[model samples]
Target: MFKNLNQKNNDSIRVEKDSIGKKEIAADSYYGINTIRAQENFNISRQNIHPELVKAISMIKKAAALSNFELGLLDEIKKNAILEACDEMIDSNLAEKLELDAFQGGAGTSTNMMVNEVIANRALEIMGMQKGDYDIIHPNDDVNKGQSTNDVYPTALRIAVLKLLGPLTKSIAKLQEVLQVKEEEFSSIIKLGRTQLQDAVPITLGQEFSAYAEAVNRDRWRLYKITDRLKKINLGGTAIGTGLNTSHSYIFKIAKHLRNFTSLSLSHSENMIDITQNMDIFVEVSGLLKAASVNLNKIASDLRLLASGPTGGIGEIKLPAVQAGSSIMPGKVNPVICEMINQLSIEIICSDQAITMAARDGQLELNAFSPIIAQKLLNMLEMMKKAIDKFNNKCVKDIEVNSDKCKQILDNSLAIITSLVPYIGYEQASDLAKEAVNQDKKLIDFIKEKDIISNSKLDKILKLENMTSPGNNLSE
Candidate 1:
């Protein structure tokens, strides 16, 4: 779908030559010769580069232009042109022109060139020159001055990931808040807790929701902590991090300008060589994402089980009926939201594995697999954010508890004998539990028939609050 969007008429082609050979580029294209070459070479994913990355790259160029102008490296007219062009790229919604695959080779050199060429041609138009007029504003010497794909690609990736984090964190916080609300709403509704799918003890439905809320809170914290790691970028570590062909002043000044432009707490790496060689930070971030996926999968699975059936399964809760569950089965409503979240969690886990392998596969001075890594990571984050939003709005907020079902299950469970242990002794309690189960009688009724304890004392001992908490003495 994206590949066919930005194509120009064949008659409007103009011949443009590069180091290797010549190609016919669309005359109206803001991207020049190198971008066309990459577009032809990597027709793989058929998907355009992410818009967030494009915006981040343009912001980087804008910041670099301002910094270069400040350092006397770029003339006023060229700097203004580059800045205006960067703004155009940033504001434009034409993502289809960015035709390179996300799985490209060369450590994102193709990606960087695409950005540089687009900016250069746009800057040329701003200066009243044709798109291919490199003499007016060269993509290499002017637009990409004092930078290499090595530094720019990773730096833009970091910025883009940071931009994405805002929505992700907001979604997670909202989910946590909704879960907390459910926790409070279900606070007094008693239910039978389970272990290994067997009755264990008594607990309020609110306690279960509270656990989900706590898990989401932990995920939110993990995301917040990892942002600090992403902040330490290698922006000025041009080429192999030696800052070769780039002045020291430009290296420091560019990062400062970027921080001002992005409003992020970004800083240049202290050891450019290490930052250039190691991708451990990305691996760590992926690991945290995997952790969050695990939590979501677990929560979704629990919701599915709890809302399994209204007649056959453990129907302790009822999920919201958003749509029909089946095409043939009448009056069927499935836990589609939970299933969607579960599937998204699995995909995120797989993407994390891909990111891990990519991070580890980096050879020496650069990770050539960074394009794939960036795409998978960003895709997972975006999908998870949307999944969370849908899950919250369509499912979690509308969930209803089966209070009668909960009480019925709790009343029949032999696990209630646990509360009688302190008063009757463990051995006696065990015997009574077996007798109650065998005779198909309520444990409280059997104990009452045997005159084991007064009705009031039994009532106090079997209180839902007492059973769910510790330090509740049976003697009291």
Candidate 2:
């Protein structure tokens, strides 16, 4: 792109030319004609590209400029100006000018050019020159030295994901911690356990909560381990990963600078060409996220069931009264927090499917579907973190177990007789269970009134710990 506006007089607009042709850009605009062309050509979603991605790209530009200067490929003056411009972008809203959708053509060429143009113009201004004065700091020759969108875009994407993973895992850990606390608090509350929605036996509520915590802990570790894959970025692999216009020296220097700039353990891919051709890493990350969402969905469903009602349903626990459940009802509260998590979990699952499909459609040397994958993956990470934090603070922390209700429900359930199988014999116990249910009586009361066993023996046999655990220590 060229900007021959050095001798121009107009204040409102300036003319810039690319191979495609010339167009008038707003003189006050930081973005150049390439960004405008992209905005016009691909008016798909109209959403801004991920801000983290823009920041990642800016860091790449800064590190690339510093490496070029260090290698004598670029002069000190231009390098300093570009570095400052990149800092401003990293620290401020300079990249808000990148107004393109997440879906675009050319494997993120438009988004890459948008970053290049913004940095080049900002560098020119930092050098006391005009915004469009490419004669001093051209976007391609200087700001984007020895880089291609094919390589830089995916590299920036990896860095962005790496940055987000820390917070996401922390959120998972927080939820797990909350569940663990709940497990400890409910350890003594024996309740009727169900299988296939039918009462089966006695189980302490703590065991159910412990299982939820273990699932979340496993997800946290899975996400934490995926970092090893995200750290292996395909940078320094110019167009098509062959290092077409770059050298080994420049590639090695750039990687060192990138590591310092982003503070991430970013390793340049050993097989850049293979990394460029395959997008399996994204599919793997999405698969793990889907697994987490499945666990979260089930946990949320369980909470909703346990907190179903105060009068008619299984009121074994109470959630925080976040909001009114109905407009017409006088007094009713809902499990809106878990419901929100349920909705977001389903959305994340859907986004994972999109990522899977995108990963599968990569062409020979590149995947134009990367923009969509990046968009979905980052979105999943961001929203899931917020959802988990909300769920932990608003719902899980304030949960109250209805122990009286639990005791009543368990005493009334005939399934509790399974504990007496050894003492009364299964056939005799089965007969007593049928007799109790037929006469609308408690199983314990029916057995005691029938003089089947001494009341003191029944008390020892039916203690909560004895019924919930393996041994009763009441030998015949």
Candidate 3:
């Protein structure tokens, strides 16, 4: 969205120094020297870290500033200035000012520093000072007080993920409800059920939709079940969960303030080392996402087959004609929504492999690879939710049931003979079904020629309700 933002840093530059050396930063930009260094080094992934993450870390900076002020560690003016800057960062597009690529080294230290630098510089503007004037509102001494990148980055990541799950869970529930609505809408339409791609029995289109509804409902609950674990976080573990170079009292103080501030039921971890070093929670999340994608892929594949052809294929259901399918063939319309969903599910499943590998590669102290995990998991959630919303609105809601086509397929299938078991007995039904195939006639017509059963009784046995559902009144 900020692609056209003024990126001409070379036009007017300001000098800033770091531990290693000095570098020139954009004079008009809020980002500082550490950001410039990372911006120059890692340009691999797309520009800008996830904005929600930037907001999360900004919230952390605000929380840290507030807590330090309450503890008498920071003066009120700098605290208020930092707080105002954080509000601006959260509410406005200030995150676009930080121009480093998402994939970077240092276990997200660069990302954390980028946020600190931008917030500090913005706070300097609010405090009537120059951008790089660290003496007034230093990024490290003021904005990032009592916090390390090891603590800030992962904690902010947890907060961002929790925020993202809100929209995604709603998307899942809406999808389930829409599927249920379709289930009820198509409840009485009978169609052939197949196993191994061969006719096996008769089932209603509603029954298939109901199964999809149940699958999606399970997925929603599976994600909801993980929410409590996601709330548990390691905030005070400054470096390696030891709280080294951090105020012990500030540990619990930050947790209390954040819970009241965000209203998210956030908790401080008793075993901060476990939470910091082991990122199994995201792995579990990736697995649930994979399961949901599998269900979606199955539904999309079924739609692809059911909406196969208008003349030469099953044609039992018709998808919404969103756009012209073929460039040359004039009236051709395709199930592009289903096709899009199919491809999206495949992308999600493959991305899950990357998250799992990143989770496993964490060293003894910290998961440096969580930056990739954060990028991958957040992207999956954002993309999946939006796509699922489009699918529900564009594809599922306007779906039309080809009732005539469904009845024709059921009427012509040899599986219809299975309905005659109660009236004619199994052996006789099977034999007549085979004989009907050999005679190249529908089972009903073949039954009439052989006088296997009276028309009245046959009609009752093959009635739409009796074949599609259960408990026929007919008996031999």
Candidate 4:
């Protein structure tokens, strides 16, 4: 009836619509019968899992189903159907008749149903039965027998997130290498260092690059730490902590099965109380992601500021131009890639906040917002990974330091006061710096006016390397 109406002309379309009584529905809005009625019923945010995330989720689900089947938690028939359905979703091979919404509330209840419907329908067809024949392979009883929304959703999320972690780890490692290379490349170049937005003293460019590398290293370690937390699965703690209504060996068996399927060495967390009630692990992961975003944002901001202008701003370093800047400003290349990374980092930070709130919002025994937390945090990871790749490849890899500009800035900076300490004494050097900065006079001019040192002595002490390098503590 529906197919006939869809193929009919306007006259037939109107007649069918009138006959059905206001039954016209958009396909995009409703993905056929397989879609959750509430999703069509609620129609909230149009947001759906991204394609990469969907693929990742499908992979996780298949692995989990395979594990359960092996453990005897699910029968072979149901397990095979679930695995096939996961592949269909992952490969976008589902038949056109059973349309499904990728978006639904209840932390992927819609997605779970999509999988259930697809598997159940496919299994029915295999048995030479029609679609929606729940008697053949029931969606809830047979297919989702040993699972709950809580366990399935979080487990799938962890598995999906872990998959992305591989790429994320590679990203940080690549960035670390780039920063180390920059350190070597800019080793001898002296540049003015800033503290609290004021010039402090001269420092070799290598030191600055080394700091970025260290930050990346720290983030990578933080990622590893959070991954340990994510590895502890709560799959067996179905419903409200206890494995009620499940077989005696089902929980342990399924978890072990999942472990083998993923090869992630996953363990059932010993503390079911912590696992079921507290989302500290979620918050901890969010914090690590937040730290990563902040670290990357700092690096990106510095790159953009350092590469600000050839004539106006501090053109201390140059970032590769990935895009045009201003429409009217000729030769107006911009650090668009770095800017994008900054923007994406900010969003990740915001998402981290959302995860934090969700963690705090959960009541005893079950976090109602686990779904949102999982979605937002996973999105943060994905965005952060992509942003890092862009910044590393398009911006950091080809960056060039303006040796002349660095030298000029270092020469003019009053922060060179420390260099004069050994010869003129600390009191005199400090006073000289203050005078130079306050009077807008050069340090050499201030020194000359104050008779702090003769020109020959000043020249000997103020060589750029001598000024910046922290030599043996002669004062000490």
Which number leads on TM-score?
A: 1
In candidate 3, the residue pairs with backbone N, CA or C atoms under 3 Å apart (3 or more residues apart, or in different chains) clash, namely none
lDDT per residue, candidate 4, 178-234, as tens digits?
A: 999999999988899988768877788888999999999999988876777788766
In the predicted model 4, the residue pairs found to clash are none
RMSD of each: 2.2, 3.2, 2.3, 5.3
Residue 196 miss distance in model 2 (angstroms): 1.8
Model 4 stretches astray by more than 4 angstroms: 1-34, 50-79, 90-108, 430-442, 445-460, 472-476
The deviation in Å at residue 412 for candidate 2 is: 1.1
In candidate 1 the C-alpha lDDT for residue 344 amounts to 89
Give the Cα lDDT of each candidate.
Answer: 0.85, 0.87, 0.86, 0.70
Query: After aligning candidate 4 to the native by TM-score, how far in Å is the CA of 175 from where it should be?
Result: 0.5
* Candidate 2 global CA lDDT score: 0.87
Best candidate, lDDT: 2
lDDT of 1 by residue, 1-476 (tens): 11222348746766778889888777777767777777778888777688788888888898889888999989999999999878877777754356677778888898888889888887887788877788888888998998898988888988989989889989999999999999999999989999999999988899999999999999999998889889887877889888887887888888888898889999888888777767778778778878888898899899999998879988999999999989999999899999998898889889889998998999978888888888888887788899999999999988999999999989888878888887889999999989988999987789889888888888888776788777663656
Model 1: residues >4 Å from true position, as ranges? 1-7
lDDT of 1 at 26: 76
Residue 33, model 1: Cα distance from true site in angstroms = 2.8
Evaluated against the true structure, the overall lDDT of model 3 is: 0.86
Stretches of candidate 2 above 4 Å error? 1-11, 423-428, 451-457, 473-476
Q: In model 4, which range of ten residues has the least summed lDDT?
A: 11-20
lDDT of 2 by residue, 196-266 (tens): 88998888999999999999999999999999988887778988999998889888988899999988988
Task: Go through the candidates in order and give the clash count of each.
Answer: 0, 0, 0, 0
